[model samples]
Target: MYAIERFESRCKKAIESILKRSVELEVPPPEIGALFALPCHGLSKYPEELAGELASKLESLDIDLVGKIEARGAYVNFFPSGEFYEIVLREILQKGDDYGSGEKKDEVIVIDFSSPNVAKPMSVGHLRSTIIGQSLYNILTFLGYKCIGDNHLGDWGTQFGALLAAFELWGNEEELESDPIRHLFELYVKFHRESEKNERLEELAREKFRLLESGSEREKELWKRFVDLSLREFQRIYDLLGVKFDYVLGESFYYSRAKRLVQRALEQGIAKISKGVVVIPLEEFGLPPLVIQKSDETTLYSTRDLATIEYRLEEFSPSKMIYVVGAEQKLYFKQLFAAARKLGFNCNFVHVDFGLVTIGGEKMSTRRGKVVLLEDLLREAIAKAKQVIEERNPLLQNSDEIAKIVGIGAVIFNDLKGDRIQQVDFDLNRMLNFEGDSCPYVQYAYVRGRSILRTAGVTKVTLESVELLSDYEKKLIELLSFFPRIVKLAAETLKPHYIAQYLLDLAESFNSFYTHCRVIGSPNEATRLAIVSATTHVLKSGLSLLNIRAPEMM
Candidate 1:
């Protein structure tokens, strides 16, 4: 068990014993089970009559794990004993990388995120979903949950039709070889421009899509090429971000199953045909009717989503299905989940909606091309990071590698350091700052701790001399002991920012300890070294959960 758990148990046991000794206790003890910080204002929900009795009883009881116990009004507070700090330090050094993890669970969790469209360039809009999903995956896996990250690619729909028409009309073989996505994007933009002037061009695109859907030999081959080119381009970005998936299935992957699922829903009367379109009416649930098929008999997003859920249920039997999508699609997920339940999918469904990423207080629109490409954002971040590295640590080796880690880490940390539901403005200047609450700051703390250990040249740690510890040292140990609880809370709440914020707090505590307590020339140098070692390991582990790297020197 963790130090915090042990402390809570001991404190509860002490309170129970005190209540048992009381003779005027007509009712049982007010369940003084929860662990609260010292100097609590009052014990909420406890009877006012027993306030004095409770305080008097708690004051008489002696708990070895608790260094100090205070009873103010009806509230009881407990502070950790010196032995508590010793146990925390020992556990951290022994557990090392596995310090913050929990026992394994036998349930599978499937996370769906980063469903970038095939024919379009990945924009900044997809950033939140990608990073947030990856963070959740890492946290759940750390806590010993079976996790499968599925990248549900947008490989079907009208966009592909537009791309196919654009290629036939304006695509060049040489330009495609040079840069497929950019070339395809330009052609796609041109097609939309031409379609406005010639309305017939729109019909041509629709017909082309119909041909592709019906398995036309030529159109199918072209459609496959577009998917192949998009996947190859998307892979480069995914590699740079250090993200991978167990399944890279797309909307087209469910095409074969979607029709059957929709037909069954219609047969069961869960979905009905209205005006030649198949939809599930959810007005009772305060959501719009979920359209599974268009009037022209074409499968829509709802169809594919339902099909994906069905496939997952049969194959993985996941206990939960989490969709990390934009807040704009809040209603869409509400409708999708409602439809899934109506269709008899009994698994837990969670829609992790995140706020939008705006540039200069303006929403991004891919249709107007008023958006920053994710690749460009990453490149600019790397360049800025390189400049910082050159200015701060010019003589450092592997400058390029370190710059990449810091640059990418800055971008990710900036996105994750706030409440997931709050809007994020992509501010490179603020994100790259080395002094503030940024990735560089936490990473620098780790580097500084390592530098201390290296200078001391202490290969082993001895706890025998740790007879006396300062307030700063004890506080640092207390913060270290809370790592496992923090991780568990983050996973339970499906919020990565909790981990991000905790790292910042832990870094602040470590910095305080480093400032006041000298580790190298201290009376208990070996004990201090152990503390420093534990801090470095924890910082690295915490950063890893956020999918960031902790450099030895920054």
Candidate 2:
């Protein structure tokens, strides 16, 4: 890759010199000040005539052909140069998998995502955070930075206490033995209905919540059981998506220091006790004053969040913290961030929220009993992929593995192929299609590129002796040449969708080049093979950033 880069830069410089020389020795007025576009076509009848024409124009104006000007009417025009492209390309290939980096201790990123609540199967809605967070993690790591992935699990408070009380009242050992989470969920639902009939039962649940908060041994054991079981269930889904976290630390993790946090905010006069609730003044920030604590003195999400921020600032000392949660919690994040800043923690705190995945014009909800499981979706996607595999290539050796990659990749890509803030209407058929802007289309393109390389065996893209004279060849070169830049942009913006779009564009360019040019049978075998190698490398690099696999077979 470094050699490839050096060659490109040298070529640019050489072309610019030739352009200036041609202009200095020009013979026509129509050739004054021509700037060459690498893959342009002829104007009059001759290729060198246009180059000569460009040289004349550049010479007349006394504008040098050194990046400032160039000449030609298409047909792979040439330009003058300094050695910038070569320097950049060499850096990329030499860096190998890590091309974007700096030396001054760039920054630290804390990404909080995939926070499914306790006692519920992970629904497809949770896929947004898990995949989006994973992609962000990949991009940040690609750049020269330290990143922290924290799964802020919902393992806290009254809900668990209610579920616990309900479990005890409707105790069933056999059901718990079979499937604890689902069985607990059923009791949870029933408890709400039953409590509506008996106020005394509701009181017992509140008392239990108090006991859990007060750190009673029995209550502690119950809460621990719920948390442990919930985590194990979440892990299964995470494993399916290839997602891991630096910290499984959750809301409960910060419970011990919560009281101290509230007390400090109170002592500093940053938070006040009013109406028996703790609050942060917000009239100056242009919103209604927020409740930082309830009258009961038990903590709220705001309290836990503010505490988490305080803890993170003290513990990890992060430079940037990203909360990859849903758009529905936009106000909550804004309030939380504002409050944290007010409390005098000036580090970068970002709340990267995405739009909802709705079904029939309503937000997907688990408590409402209208939800789809992520496992189910993955299973379905794979099943459909298995069918496609059979139809496309039945004798494939590892059908299951391939189907899993393609199917799961489709689901991950479907959620990520658009603006993260744009709402999605779930459509299974559209996601599975291999013909459009889907994962399969990109995978097929990579496979096709690989096939070209295989047939052109014994030769690869290098800084070998070859000329890039064809317009199609230049177009392909330019496309692959922009990978490092594109990847850098995506990483800086914390957006994987940009990288996804780039892959689609690269694949399109490959397809177009294939349609217009002869690769394997070309007269200049080295040049054709060079373009082939560059395309393969770029595709592999791009797919890896998006965390998608590039199978060498269609």
Candidate 3:
């Protein structure tokens, strides 16, 4: 356990024990819940009388780890003694990269994210799901939960019928073989355009989809080709983004199961046909009716999603299944979860919805080709980073490699530096600003600390000669003590912003300490160097949790 957590736990126990021993005052224990951790800022929110009462109650008790507790006006503070600092610093230095990780957990969690439709380029819109899901995976895994990343690809449905129809009408084999996604996207756009004028195209598309669903050899082969080529394309982006999934189960993978499920639902009277389309009415649940199958018996995403839930339950029996999807589908997921509950699914379902990414206040659309391709955005960031690097450090070795790390890290940090539900206006300048609350700033802090340690020729750090500490050193240690708690909070809340904001605060704090405390030739050089080393480890570990690389140099 971390020093801060240990302190809080002991404080809670002490407070509870004190309440149990009280006779004259019938003080309820629930009122004292907020009084634990009595740190400098812990009791400021409580009433002065309550603070004093708690202080008087526990001032006599002998707590080993706690140093002193006192109430001042409406604010009460607890000062951790030298023993707490010793334990916190020693644990950080001893554990190194494993400082914040937890014990193993038996429960499994499946995260479904980054599920872009096949044959369409990944846009800025897909960035949130991909990175957010990856960060959650890292955090949950670090906290000892068995996490499964499932990239539930959108490879089946009526849209594919339109794509196939478009391809048969105007697609060139050579163009498709050369630039698969672009050509496929053009074909898709053309289909929507022509269908606006030619109603016959709609029937043609439905027929093509029916054929594909019914297992026509040629249709299946074409669809398989599309899926294969799309996967190769998606892998390139995933490689650049450092994203990997344990399962790449597409909608097609669950089609047969979905069909069987719909049949069972119909026979059991859980679903009914209206206007020749199968649906589960959720009006009683205060949601619109959920369509599981179209009029032509083509399975919809809802059908496949329910089938997916069933498959996960029977296969992994996960304790929780989280979907990292856009907020636009908020209602749809609620309906899906409600339908699943009605069908008696026992697992927990969570929709980790995020706001949309917009360019000039406009949501991206494939049909209009108004979206920025993720590859284009990433490559542009790299180029911008390279330009900045050359200007800053002309003779830096492996500048290209370093640029990739900084560029990609900046983009990711920009997305995660705020609340997940807040809309991000795609801005590369803000993301790449080295002095701002960007990833590069935090990365540079690590690089600066590493440089200090290298100059000191300190391959190993110890807290033995850490006597005569300054206020700055103590403040830095206090901030460092909160890292494990921050990690646990981020994991519990399913919010990476907690860690991001914490890292920013930590980096800022370290910078302040570095400015105030001299390390190279100071009397407390060993102590300050230990502080630098611990800060670098935490910065690196926290960045890894967000799936961003921390370069040794900037």
Candidate 4:
């Protein structure tokens, strides 16, 4: 247990004992359970005379670990002793890399994210689900939950039907073989354009999809080719981002299972054919009806999604299944979840929806080919990172490697630094800027701390060498004490932005300490160096949880 946690526990025990003996209260109010709540403030639930007595009793307790306790009318404030800081620092040094890790949890959690559709090039719009999902995986794993990062690929849909129809109409064999994904993407865009003019194209596309679902060998072979080509291209982007998934289950993987699932739903009277389309009416759940199968008998995403929930439950029996999707699909997920309940699979379904990513204030649209491809954005960012490195540190070795780290890290940090539900506008210059609340700024702080540690040559720090702290030291220590809590909070809330904001604050605090305090030549050199050492470890660990690299020097 951390020093602050232990102290808080002791205070709670003391307060409970005091209230039980003096106030004759059988049950403590919820406020009393809050951290650092004024004892007398919650005691006001009782009579005024009794609350005063309880406060007086708390002040007279024989505990000195807190150093002092004062009762100011309807409030009691306790100040932690100096030994608290010493123990916290000692424990941090003792734990080192394992400071914020929690005990193993006996529950499994499945995270489904980064599911870009096959044949569509990954774009800036895909950034949030990919990195956010990876970050949540890191945090939950650190907190000891058995996390399964599943990349649920979008390989089956009406969109693919359109792509197939387009390819058969105008696709060139040499063009497709030379550049499969781009060729397929252009064909998809063309299908939508042509269908807008001639409605017959829409019917043709639906028939092609129906043929594909009915196992036409030709259509199946073409679908496999698209899947193979798209996955290879997607892997390159995943490699550059340093993301990995335990499973890459596409919608096709669940398509056949969805047929059986829909049959079962029909047998159970959970669904019915309405106007030749199968749907589950969910008015009681405050959601619109969920379409399971189209009028042409081709399955929809809802059918596959329910199958996904069923498969995950029977396979992993996860305590929770999180879908990291865009905010536009909020209603779709609600309908899916409600349909799942109707189907009698009662698993925890969470939709972690995030706002859309716009490029220069324009919403990305693949149908119009107006989206910025993720591969292009990454390459441009890395090139710009190389240019900045050359200008800042001409003598730096392995600058290429460092630029990738900084550039990619900046893009990821920008995505995570704001609220998940807020729209993210891409601006590489702002993200890579080293002077503000960007990844480079935080990385630079880490580099500076590392330089200080290397110069000090202090391999270890002990409580014996530490003494009284100045305001700067005290501020840093107080901030450091919150690291463990911050990590746990990020895990619980499923928000990586909390960790991002915390790192920015820590970097700002460390910079302040560096400016106002002397370390190497000061009389409290060992003490200040300890602070620097701990800060670096935390900065590195926090960045790692966000799936960002912390370079030694940037």
Candidate 5:
């Protein structure tokens, strides 16, 4: 158990014994300087009376972890013992990388994110879903939840028909071989532009899509090539981002199952036919009706999504299904979840909705060719990071590798540092600033801690020799002890930004300690060395939860 857990348990026991009743306690913030809260349901009218009674009872208890117990109104607050720092520090050093991790839960979780469309390059808009989903996966897995990341690829739809039509009209084998995604996107753009001038081209594209869906050999072959080429390009980006999906199930994977799902829904009366179209009427639930099939009897996105839910439940039996999507799709998920519940799915469903990522106050639009490619963004970030590395530490070896880590880490950190639902503007200048709440800043703190440990050259830490630690040391230890709690909160709230902010706080604490305290040749060198080592481990582990790398030298 963690030191805080032990403290909470002992405090609860003490309260229970004193009041002769079961009590639940909560840990307040550090600045509040209160460690526990006791409900005074029966004594609300006499809060001071309850406070006096509990204070007397707490004083009589034989608790060593708490040095002082005070009554504030109807609540009793417990303060940690002077020796708490020693206990927490020793535990941190002993646990090392596993200091803040929790025990495994006996449930599986499914996460759907980064579902880029086929024959299209990933744009900046996809970054939020990818990085946020990856971070949540990391945090939940760290907390011992069985996590399954599914890249629900958008490999089906009328868009593919447009691509096939354009390719048949003007595709070049050599151009496609040189750059598949770019060539395919150019063809897609051309199709839309021509269709704007020639309305018949739209019908032709729809015909091509219908043929593809009906499994025409020629259309199927073209569709397969588009999916294959798109996946290859996506794989390159995923590799750079260090993202891996357990299931890369695309919309086409559900094409066969969608008809069955619609039939089941119709049979179960979950869906109804109206005006030659099939939909689930959610008007009573104050939501738009969910369309399952078009007037032509062709399936829609909702149909595929419903099929996906059915398939996932049958395959994984997940305790929770989380969709990491933009907030604009709020109503879509609401209707989907409601339909699933109405269809008798007895499981948790959540939509982890995030705000938009804009550039210069304008939303990204791939159709208008006014968008930033994720690959281009990453390469530019790497290049800028290389410039910084050369200026700061030209003598550093493997500079390119370090630049990659720092550059990518900066982008990820900037994305995750804000609340998940808050809108974020992509500003390269601000994100790469090493002096702010960026990944580079926290990483540099980790490097500083490592440098201290290396310079100290201490192999062992003696607890007895570590007495009467300085104020900064105490603050650092206090912050370190809160790591497990922070991890738990992040997992419970499904907020990766909590971990990111916690890391920034821990980094700041360590920096203050480094600035104020000496470790290399001090009287408490061994003790300080132990603190430095523990801080380094924690920073690395915390950064890893956000799916950001912490370079030892940077």
Candidate 6:
């Protein structure tokens, strides 16, 4: 906020002066040099081209400049004077972690994500939402938005009735105590198979379902027991994955509300009788009419979602609601949004859909049992990381700690490095590598920056009578200046991969700067120390945004 006010005042005065002079002198104002890059154009490095081209143009125009614009080949560059350095660096150092955190609007956002069903194991596919949603939460919260994480648990449906029938017939009292989800899984498998052979058992399940809907005391108690038991199992997996939801309200939670919601739709003429089922007449809106209520009177996901939508708006008054679900539900979300709009929802809605998380070109699902547990994948990554740490440095101290920082980081960062739309093949070999575009490599770059700073005994960063810094340092600083802008872009675009890629670029640039410039015992120790500190801060901030840990000692 302070930066905004300060920049506003300065920019206004500068532009006003330029305008006044332009009219007085009857000449156009000189173009401002704003971009920075390394020279790589016309056989020159990006930094050289940036400086030469802009410097020549401005000199020709006879405009007294405050800074130099240079380039190296394809890269354009900028170097501000000592005054600029003092102002920018002091602001960043003063703000610390709050350096880039602009006070964004106090908007409420309902993030419906990772809506895993009860008694279901979290697979690698779930890991996509787990990481994506968590990172999005961090980014939005960092931007000062009030975010509500909603876990729309799949707890109501025909599946529960089948599960109950199976539990009653083949339920073991002891295995439920040891492992409830697995026990339910077994019962569910058996009940599904036996439902075809026995009509009495099937009728009993149907009666129980009816009793559940009709709010019988025994049915309520049974449903509560099943939900509690399932939740007990779900929480363990959620805890392991570091996911916490503000609300874990299930599908059943809105059954009562759904009944009222459908009735209102009927009263409002949004619901119509079609094919003997209550349907929303949306044929004019490029889609067929949707069944709002079935002839049997059982509600669907769309019905519960409509109620959920109305409830969320009433409860949180969110400015935006984003659902991070699988791509297969694209049509479902479209219908929900359309129905909500048709029913007069004024809030902005978004569905963040992502491709499946597959391994070795095969779909991962529970039915096929081809799914990889997130825990198992993480453990394997950690194990491989441990091996890498040992092989790289036999005397590496605190191997377990380093392994974790790198291992878990690899899993998270690997997925984050690409756009969320990109389908990940979940290659273990690629994820665990210490070289070539891996998470550990980026962390190593940070450790290198820290190492350099430590060697220089960097107790303080002082602004010297600065001139045009060399290509590497100036280009690197230009990259550092991109942090705030990139943060804004990431939040606006609803894409964390933007920040991820920017961090990698900064790391790669820092490596080049390190190879070229020596900070410790240098004649220009202050300048180099400033660069090292900036690099370390940027890497730290970037890694933290992705929920990845950075090891100072690595």
C-alpha local distance difference test of each model:
0.84, 0.72, 0.86, 0.84, 0.86, 0.72
Ranking by TM-score: 3, 5, 1, 4, 2, 6
Error of 4 at 404 (Å): 0.8
Stretches of candidate 2 exceeding 4 Å from the true structure: 1-106, 192-204, 458-460
**Candidate 6: TM-score?**
0.83
Residue 318 in model 2: lDDT: 92
Candidate 4 lDDT score at position 323: 92
lDDT of 1 by residue, 63-161 (tens): 666776555454455667778888888888888878989789998999998999886789888889999999999999999999999999999887778
Candidate 4 lowest-lDDT run of ten: 24-33
| Candidate 4 local distance difference test against the native | 0.84
Tell me model 3's lDDT, rounded to 2 decimals.
0.86
lDDT of candidate model 6 versus the reference = 0.72
Model 2 deviation from the true structure expressed as Cα RMSD, one decimal place:
7.5
The TM-score measured for candidate 4 stands at 0.92
TM-score of 3: 0.94
Error of 3 at 435 (Å): 2.2
For every model shown, what is its TM-score relative to the native structure?
Answer: 0.93, 0.83, 0.94, 0.92, 0.93, 0.83
Stretches off by above 4 angstroms in model 5 are: 16-56, 71-76, 193-197, 458-465
The stretch of ten residues in a row with the least summed lDDT in candidate 3 is 22-31
Q: How accurate is candidate 1 locally (lDDT)?
A: 0.84
Model 3 C-alpha RMSD to native: 4.1
TM-score of candidate 2 against the unseen true structure: 0.83
